[model samples]
Target chain A: MPQQRVVRTIIIADQQGLHLRQAVECAQAAGRYQSQIILVSGERRAENCRSPFEILQLGAGYGAAVTIEATGPDAEQAVEEIAAILSRQTSH
Target chain B: MEIKRGVAVSPGVAIGPAWVLDTEEVRIGERFIATGTYPEEIERFDRAVQAAANEARQIQKTVSERLGEQYGAIFGAHAALIEDPNLRQEVAAQIRDHSFTAEYALSRVIRRRAKILAGLNDRILADRQSDLFDIEKRLLRQLVGQRQAQLQKLSEAAILLAHDLAPSETAQLDRQHVLAFATEAGGRTSHTAIVANALGIPAVVGLGPFLTDVSGGDLVIVDGNRGLLILDPDAETLERYRQAQAAQAGHERELIELRDLPAITRDGVRILLLGNIEFPEEAAQILERGADGVGLYRTEFLYLGRKEDPTEQEHFQAYLKVLRQLPGKPIVIRTLDIGADKFRSAVEPPAQERNPFLGVRSLRLCLHNKSLFRVQLRAILRASAFGDVRIMFPMVSTLAELREAKLLLHDVMDELNEEQVPFNPQIPVGTMIEVPSAALIADLLAKEVNFFSIGTNDLIQYVLAADRTNENVAYLYNASDPAVLRLIEQVVRAAERHGIPVNVCGEMGAEPMYAFVLIGLGLRQLSTPPSAIPELKRLIRSITVEEARRAAQAALQMESAQDITNYLRDQIRRILPEALAV
Candidate 1:
């Protein structure tokens, strides 16, 4: 069977954008799934969802739209979790 | 004689060599390397990255352990940014592609990243540029084989002038050499300011771009008392500051001498000098400075920086710590003075009020949250058995509110009695005379409480209809205002009639000059910061109560606040010239 792929466009709603702590949270949440997750915004793409540095390099600040893409058996769950983390307007 | 004004955090004056701390940037020009030396450049960059990572980790660990996990996490963020695979790859690619020096390559790559973060147009995102800059500098220092200027190890005494010092940097400040500090950024309650205060270093912050106007080794005067930084003063000004500095030293010596002496005025009027403290640990400083006891131990600090409401055991432990610290000394523990600026995350106040100052806060909030209030009261009562402890309720406006608070205290006492916990049954209860309503009805209010502590900071601001924190209306918020003095006068008279001891425990009482007026107003007990005790005690001992009484009478008759202020200043200068000098 072809690898299942899930993609979702989500707006970064946190006031601090994809800063270190938030990036770490996203990375931790993404690590729980078996799927490979990637975040993309404009010309920038962070394929290493578990790398906070890569997430920060995306520069996806407040109001910036980013695409969360996942490919695996649990692709749908991975994309939903990562997308929810990015979309939530909270620090904790 | 250029004077830059900032917010005064710690009070004192310092005239010394200026030490400009421009750590944000290191002037490093691009240097070309031979094409064959690309391998060497990459190796150097790799080493620097490793060293920087190690340093970041150490900083994170030490800071987290010392301060808190939240604060220590910043260094972890820095380490993560530094160890970014993309950043390392970009620098290495630059070193190979252009035969550029490692420092230059790293600088360029980091600068580009910072630019990208800045261009995001989000304020919080834009701040990340500083993180980028900090990491870049850390790497560059490691690569260049140079240690970052150690602020903790200054060669000589100097006034530290910086845009700002982080809490970590401020914590490591050499108390012996850095006579004082002035920064371009920070508020009175910022971590740096708080550390500065705790370390007893006079500091002024919020002077914009002070580093730009000052050079290292130039004569600078940091008037922390007035929040003024004078750069390269004229000879006359230098002479003036020198005398002031000398006077400060002399005044300190004089006050230290009087530390073992009682704070009694001439003609045998004994005044009690107490320390207003937040943390129990500060009780030592209070005792060191010769404070008779803790006048006000704000219990609100226990509520801060925690998600969960402090348990009864936690509150009991905290009160126990303060009580044990000052064994037999009187310690007035104000119960949960939260709301109207002081708040805890544990207690969710209703959606932001249109007027929070007048909204449900302080005693009102406590009344609503009976469970929380009861826990605090139980702790206070339990701790009172250990030492001389007094329970004070803050922001009590009405007789009904006071009665309600007392009724709840009675309930807590009954609960403790049923539990068979040993507590001081007669733990002298008091109410802070801060509200205008409380002050106006002091005669009736005085009948209920054991003593009265005039919280003049709020009383003056409230009575004048001005928010002291609001810069625009700050001019109207003067304790010397005739109206404020009259209200204070009313409370003092009421307390006198009831034969209840009244103390002034506010910013007004902290001022040696203003304290003299309070003395004249029949406030025999003054509670201020531990740092101000010596100076206040000296002023008390220098003047007679009769003299302060005359000044108070004249001040009350004055029409304007400015007139009253000027009159008091002149009177203080005449009676205690050394008091004005310090």
Candidate 2:
């Protein structure tokens, strides 16, 4: 089968934006699947989604739209997970 | 004195010279280097980053355990940032192409990253600028060969003034030299605040850049009782504080005078006041404060500040030190209570714990690692030969854990016997009634142990399913909660039925309001930090058993913790207002 890819743009809803906890949750969740997960904020793209440092370095703050892209067997699931984390109102 | 206000985390009065601990700023100016030095510079940068990452990991473990997992994750991000391939590549490329010094290149990259985040035009992204700053500071500190300021090496006893203290740094503070601490940043529930309270020092945090206003070695008074920091007092202010200090000293003198006397209530009921100590050096303070014995000698300190587990000899020597200090006084040596808020890298690798409070720690960790348990047991047994030592297993949730621990103790005793080494064969064995299950089954557990010491700190948390460290659920972590009281009552009643002496060794016993409730619950023995002994003894002496029992009963009947707290506070206020500073 040809490699599947899924991409979705989600606005960061967390009031504190993509801080350590949210970034950690995203990275930790991304680690669950065998997919190449990448987050794009305007021109800056973070391919190392497993590292909270890289995701947070993107500096996608509150209400900032960031694109989540995943390519692999679990591409769709990875996109869903990243989007879910972005849409979550509270990090705690 | 020029006074400033902040949140009072720990209560006391401390007047001393201010030892200002300012964070060192590393200004990395651009320096062009030779072409041949690029590899060496890059290598140097890598080593610094590696060292920084290791430091961050260690800090992360401590912060995670002390604060919460989420708070700990900040350090995780820091470590990641330090080891970020993108960051490393940028600095390496800058050094290779621009011929810049490693520090210069790294600084430039970090500044650009921080600037990007700051310019994000969103609150969340903007706040991350601080995180970048933290990473830069850590890396630079590593590169500059500058160690984190050592609070352990003060020449004289002084009130510490710092911008903010990391939990690890706070843990390193020598209570002898650092009389008190006033931080320019930190909330009431900050790590510094918790550690200050644990160290029994007066502390004021959130003073907002008070460091800039005061010079090092200047006279400063930290009135933690009122959350005030006074700088360079006038004669009248100095006189006032001196008098207050003298009066406080005089009060302590009075309490010390009663040291030789028994802690007897007005009704002629004698109460046993023991000291909860973590180190052998605290024996002097405990004895000076008039404690009957060491109730809880938290042996976890042996496992901290080292890369390797303490040897059998090391453990014995440490126990012997404390044992020798107190010849006649019963020293209840709790065997390695490592878990929850307390962790040792030397004992085991860090596990990703969802809820460490409920995880395998304390006696559970001991049972799992029998050899480690046996070594401590052997040490405790050997130390018992020199002094009145009792071996207590902490965090015993079930009879099985209690049995497993005892069985290991027996094995150690057998091993000692085989080696023909002398040990106290009849050293009293006990288990802490901290876990709610253990509290619920206290009657059953009473059959196995020689005595009971209620660790109310964990008992309250376990009973309420609330993490005491967490600020969000802090309200539910109250010891005055009727549910928590009921559990304490249960443990007390169980001990009573079994004819075993029950003592409270948690912070609850130290607090006046909760102390009243604990006394009323029939806990005649109370162990607390040595600093609290004087005030607590005075409180105990003022109130009769009947009054305490009545107050406890009233507290038990109250539905809400707030109501119970109010009822007890009112009772305490009506009875012995002087015992309580607030």
Query: What DockQ, on C-alphas, does every prediction get?
Result: 0.18, 0.19
Instruction: List the per-model TM-score of the A chain.
Output: 0.90, 0.91
Best candidate according to DockQ: 2
TM-score of model number 2: 0.64
Which residue runs of candidate 2 sit more than 4 Å off their true CA positions? A1-92, B1-92, B101-103, B109-261, B279-284, B301-311, B336-361, B368-372, B395-401, B435-444, B461-494, B546-567
**Model 1, stretches more than 4 Å misplaced?**
A1-92, B1-132, B135-167, B177-245, B340-349
lDDT tens string, model 2, B517-543? 888989899999988887788888888
Per-candidate local distance difference test? 0.82, 0.80
Q: Please state the CAPRI-style docking class of candidate 2.
A: incorrect
Model 1: per-residue Cα lDDT at residue B51 = 95
- Summed over model 1, clashes come to 1
Per-prediction TM-score to the true structure, in the order listed: 0.70, 0.64
What class would a CAPRI assessor give candidate 1's docking? Answer: incorrect
